[model samples]
Target chain A: MKAVGINGYGTIGKRVADAVSAQDDMKIVGVTKRTPNFEAKRAVELGYDIYMSAPDRENLFEEADIPVKGTINDLYDKVDVIVDCTPGGVGAKNMADYEKAGVKGIFQGGEKHDQIGRSFNSFSNFKESVGADFTRVVSCNTTGLCRTLNPIKELAGINKVRAVMVRRGADPGQVNKGPINSIVPNPPTVPSHHGPDVQTVMKGLKITTMAILVPTTLMHQHNLMVELDSSVSVDDVLDVLEKTPRVIPVEASSGLGSTAEIMEFAKDLGRPRGDLFEIAVWKESLNIVDNELFYMQAIHQESDVVPENVDAIRAMLEMETDPQKSIAKTNKNMGIIG
Target chain B: MKAVGINGYGTIGKRVADAVSAQDDMKIVGVTKRTPNFEAKRAVELGYDIYMSAPDRENLFEEADIPVKGTINDLYDKVDVIVDCTPGGVGAKNMADYEKAGVKGIFQGGEKHDQIGRSFNSFSNFKESVGADFTRVVSCNTTGLCRTLNPIKELAGINKVRAVMVRRGADPGQVNKGPINSIVPNPPTVPSHHGPDVQTVMKGLKITTMAILVPTTLMHQHNLMVELDSSVSVDDVLDVLEKTPRVIPVEASSGLGSTAEIMEFAKDLGRPRGDLFEIAVWKESLNIVDNELFYMQAIHQESDVVPENVDAIRAMLEMETDPQKSIAKTNKNMGIIG
Candidate 1:
């Protein structure tokens, strides 16, 4: 089995470890945490080899009655690849260590795209990251847009795409991150950083993105208006999207409507933390009038990129060069389609 | 006071009656219900003169311990005007009766635009129905599109307007309504009736629409993309929207993000039934990209037209010729903008 080590056992790290653990071709070697918090203990309970990021903090894990394997560097020596989920800027600093240790690393979106020469979004540009030592999994929102836009571009050809990204204020677990009573634009400017981030994975797509951070912590909703090169019916658009492995269509008849209902569906499906790892596309919302197609889809911030991370590993190691096969394996192993 | 009678005491009718009660120029003469349901009783409790649509069901109210004031014709004879709130197709049948009674009437979206010679939307084309005795208030989705589009049309002018209407399956109270688990297109056809409905009010606009009904009780979200006559600044678009009384800017800082939070905000504002009678525009989501202006806004289905109903009453009676003044009074009495 290809061994995968994840640094920073927080939201994304823990999820990536779980995803990698589910894969047949790969195994999770270890997960690193800076502090001996509840999540660290939870990681130990999941049977992951726990490594302390700071060697000085080894005693704290022991005091908390959580067993520790070694330091983060020690994990690099053992694993074939490392998925860096360290808080944003910290991943940039850790890149040098990853290079010196001679292990491939996958950085999360929080890190700058320039940190890794090639940015990865599983299906959109999986081939671009082939044989690359380091690849960054674009942010959850960017991944959603790329996954969505790429299909439309291939199937119908894009003329101009405009998307209004309604982002969540915080993750459900983030207690302190919010303006609680107000809608705040992350940056009080025109054309948010999201569109440029999409370019990192999907180049040559003329797209403009505007975002607003809302109070809900469930998922980020993206309202996309894609103008196609030629006219395509709503049926044709829905068929293409439905065939995409990671796009989960939210139906009206299942009695699930809101993001709240979707969360309940995930929990009922026995998913950990009720995380919806796929882009929940409102099936009914898919409509094309004239040459333009419009749909609204929700992206689960923490877990959407988890499956991408698994595929990114496959891409980096050349274990599965074909995106379709790799994504199929990841989606199947994670019980994505029930 | 001008006597205004509501011909159906359902979702839109009850709310319309409440709005009329709040206005100084008009009074709710009575409301009609086919059966003595709980809502009919609530209409009585709200002090509306309860008119029985089917005289045979008048005793049903007595059996339900509810009081009935008179038959439908009795209400027509007593009131100066009628607002038909019955379901679609039912209003078309009632139109002939309204004309025979020589009582001016207002019809809800369920009726065909041709059923009433003049189609009405409060601010958009209040003047168009200056002396027309009968007017039909457009559907909830059309109202939302008009509220957002009219301002843009006035400020920048539109080369083309495209919208995708993501409609709710049913009101929270409509338990039997919806596909429940399937995202079904309303007509299973391109260009839903909503686009033509908008034309009934604002004529000669190049527009197209598609719609899907999802399982949600709260509101309908309209994803709009407008190509303007000339490129305008993002601030300029926002300035125009902010100045419109019926268009509410949902701030990101107020911690109000989703329709759920906006509904809660309405509840906290002590609105009756927590109804937000204005369009909740995501201010932060508004952006102008290379002559294309994009934004996402939600219309609370139940009460949005209530304010329009109040405005329509003034327009029908020539009570307030200025839409700005009529809309202002409607907003003030309803506590729309504090």
Candidate 2:
């Protein structure tokens, strides 16, 4: 069994820590937080060792009566891999610490793709990450894109992909982020970074993406128009998507019409934190016009990548060399569905 | 001057009444309300005559100390045209009453296209509405689509159009309507009604639209991917959109990064109720990869159609035969700027 230490006890960090704990071949040795907030106290209650990210600010925890398992360096000493969930650029800054400690680092998508050298989505680049010392898990949106597009590309081949990503303005817990009552063309530019981000994982894919931020906190929705190499039936497209791991084909007929309903379904299914690790594709939205395939999918931003992080850890530690087997193990342990 | 009766003093109705009051060629003879709501009281304070839609419900208004200006029939008898602002489907139910009253009926987008026999977008079909007895102003989204696409079609000819409409979940005061925290694939079906609705105005235009409703009350944003008949420079495309009536090009650099800022900009500009009648297109989002043109535009759902309603009235009454002249008159009277 490999020991995993989660470096950041926030949204993605806390979830990854739980998922790693559930895996039979891996365990969360500890999780880190710079502040003695409610999440830090909750981590203590869950009996996970809490590591302080800021070595000099250890007193903040003592005053809040939240016990600490020494600083991040000490956690690194006990773990074989560190899953860094520190906000975006901060992960890049934390890279040196992981390097100095000689621990394999699994970074989140926020960091620059070049900084980590490899960008990963279990569905797209699992084999490429095996036995690597470090790899970055792409953001929720990109991971979602790769999971669906890579499968379709393998099935009928793709000439090009044009997607419009309607992203949520903020996560439920993120009170500061906004577009609060507006829809913003996030970068207000063509192929807004996401298309190029997807290229980081699935190389040589012809894709262009444009995104807008909406005043929603539930999930990001992507409307994809893929120009296939040849004509394909809607059933054939749906077949590939339904068979793909970590993708659930939700139909409007099932009353799972929107992201809200999907999230509610997750809660009903007893998923932790009402999280949906799978991408929910609207089966009713699948359509074919000659060579073009259009469909819509919802990405639960906070949890979709949590399972990806678990798979990345296994790949980096070489515990699971086969991509499919690793993905299966991660899914089974986390209770992820098709 | 045409005397206009605004039937249904709700969200669209109240705004249309105010807009009509501002126009020199039109005046709101009266507005109808079913009950003595706050809006009804506000309508009275505005010094406009208030008509009771439910004549039997007049006692409800009398008990609330609000005076009624006879029944809807009384207002219709005095008006040359009636701008039906009733909710969707509700307007269709009132069509027979309009026919009996012998008043030219101008319906909101909520009603069916066949019910009114013609759909009007001043920029797209004002001339077609001239001397007509009835014309339905397309919904805010359809009006917005026609304004931009028609201009572009005239400029470079559109081969096809694909749009993803990220719609607002509820109007500002519609606390009852929702997916309050979710992003919904409105119909969760390919080519949502919007595409067919647009076809009602810009006939023979190849287009497909998919809409997702998000938790917001400010505006609806459209991400349009238009395949042009031939290559066009970004400047040329921008020129066409910039010169279009009822369309304003906004940039992120100006801090109008999202709909919230745009709404705030409207408030700052002294627009009543902070409503944006013009579609705010993100100038920086305008880009062309060969013949495929991509851009994002925001439609203030509450008011974008207000000016369209005004123009439809002028057309049906033959107050202006030239579409351009009517559009200019409507824009100037309502302070609409590109």
Best by lDDT: 2
Per-residue lDDT tens digits for candidate 1, residues B156-187, read 99988766666767788888886353334464
User: What would the DockQ be for model 1?
Assistant: 0.10
Q: Which prediction has the highest DockQ against the true structure?
A: 2
Per-prediction DockQ scores?
0.10, 0.78
- Candidate 2: what lDDT? 0.89
Can you write out model 1's per-residue Cα lDDT over A1-338, one digit (the tens) per residue?
A: 89999999999999898889999999998999989999988888889988889878867888899888889878988998999999988998999999999999999999999877779998789998887899999999999998778887889999887776767778878899863533444553447889899988888888877665655677777777788998788888888888878887777556555566777788999998788888888777677767788787778888899999999999999898899999899999998872
- What is model 2's DockQ versus the real complex? 0.78
Show model 2 residue runs off by greater than 4 Å. Answer: none
lDDT tens digits, residue span A262-324, model 2: 888999999999999999999999998767888999999999999899889988888888889
lDDT of each: 0.82, 0.89
